[model samples]
Target: MARFVKEIMSPAVVALRPDASLVEAAQLMRAQDVGDVLVAQDGVLLGVITDRDIALRAVAEGLDPLTVSCQSVCTPDPVCVGPEEEITTAQRLMRDHAVRRLPVVDGRGTVGVVTIGDVVQDRDPDSALAHISRATPDL
Candidate 1:
């Protein structure tokens, strides 16, 4: 079982500048096969934008994705966890924030992302969510 966030986190953090367009962020997500992207500038953590944010906040509102900036729609100052933090602490933060993912930060910057799926997989590999998390994403 993973004892810390760094143990189970997906270390490849897909990030974009805050000025990046929603379309660009969406495209990045598609290319990365990730559901979310960290909005940053100069290696500073800014916000988090998710696929649902693009769909519900922009597309559903009839806003042009090309014109909408990620910073304008992203959840700003998102709750984060340290890479060295205990796995249970990450789980608690996720539960409290009602967020599915958390940015794993260290002194350097955002290093990774820990998702509920990661926690589930680490804590209970035989669970349905764990099984689903391990499955290959559909194209």
Candidate 2:
């Protein structure tokens, strides 16, 4: 493992503020072409809103997306990981919680987001066949 999270983590991310409306958050995700958005304020981490979160947590509940704040439905005080932590650490957290995504934070601030897909995609498999079979695998 690397001394820091930069060694085994995605480098890019999408982030939003808890104060943002669901509509605004959705637009940010759309614009970024990402599946989730980190909810934060100032330099502090807050929660996460996944694309699935929008569909299942809000739309399915028949709530007004335009009026609801992402904070209202986001997984607040979300489980997070350090950038320097081992990749397996995050994988375990996801497996235990049955979560698809995790926010990555460093000393400066939020640096990236990791998903079950990213973990499986980035990890080396036992063999080449296994690697190819799961490369870009749908999670």
lDDT of 1 by residue, 98-138 (tens): 99999999999999999999999999999999999889888
> What is the Å distance of residue 135 in model 2 from its true position?
9.7
Q: Give the per-residue Cα lDDT of candidate 1 at 4.
A: 94
Q: In model 2, which residue pairs have backbone atoms overlapping below 3 Å? A: 4-84, 5-83, 5-84
Best by lDDT: 1
Worst 10 residues of 1 by lDDT: 1-10
RMSD of 1: 1.2
Determine which window of 10 residues in candidate 2 has minimal summed lDDT: 130-139
Candidate 1 residue-wise lDDT at 81? 98
Compared with the true structure, what per-residue lDDT tens digits does model 2 show for residues 39-126?
Answer: 8888788888888888899999999999888988898888888887888889889989888788887788888877766676567456
